[model samples]
Target: MGGEIKQIFEILETNARATPEQISTMTGIPAAEVEKTIKKAEKERTILKYKTAINWSKLGEEQVWALIEVKVVPQRGVGFDAIAERIYRFPEARSVYLVSGTYDLAILVVGKTMQEVALFVAEKLAPLETVQGTVTHFLLKRYKEDGEILEGEEGIKRLPVSP
Candidate 1:
């Protein structure tokens, strides 16, 4: 079980969208076994979710991505979860995390334009009762995502060396 679990995770870490048959073929495990292991991993929360990596820039969607540092006042007993839930519910929010430092939360957001993102931050996010302050930084470029290079389809090339 441990070996199977490890193989499953290794395959997923390398390629998140790898099919069960591909994993089974690569690991020499039965397809049914791979399926069972994946289910177990999902149930254990080791595998949270499956997602696709998109090149939004190439899509010409006029998209803007930003990372927002947020300071929030936790409720007397509810803690950060209550406030985090509210932020995550927003459609613009792509990801959220609890981080250490001056800020309590880090949120990733995407919008159609800079103005749209700013509106979301100023009108929707900042006005929340628990939110104290926010700092936003827009992403200019990404070198890689999900272990794939964003620039081109070419893999790393090695220079010829004399024997």
Candidate 2:
């Protein structure tokens, strides 16, 4: 890839809402070329989807999220692909990834309530044949998500005490 195209990708990745004109201004590339590059990237699936980093807590919506560390036995020939696919097929599994360390896979799951997530683990996840073990950690709070800070950066200002 050309340096210009790579720069375009980096700019878009950081902020998907960036317009071609804006990118052109930032990168000093022609506006038409910027548009053309972005379109090509979309067609090639390099740019999957544009998203907004939402602060759900501000909305006062109750959302329970969990990160499940799974230990699975890799299938012969297929390795971890088959097992990972099977787990990801469930609608509750938001994101599934084959990872290193002690765990074979890491799954991000969401639910309406804590009980619902617990039920999903006991009833659905644990019973899977390929699943050797799992450790689930409930997300209590999100300080930062998708490189966006949820809380505003404002430190308390204090007046020094007079001696």
Output the lDDT of residue 7, model 1.
86
TM-score of each: 0.82, 0.86
Clashing pairs in 2: none
lDDT of each: 0.90, 0.90
For 61-94, candidate 1 gives per-residue lDDT tens digits of 6778899999999898889999999999998999
Return the TM-score for candidate 2, rounded to 2 decimals.
0.86
The runs of at least 3 residues in candidate 2 whose Cα sits more than 4 Å from the true structure, single-residue gaps closed, are 154-163
Would you give me the overall lDDT of model 2?
0.90
RMSD of each: 2.9, 5.0
**Model 1: lDDT to the true structure:** 0.90
Strongest candidate by TM-score: 2
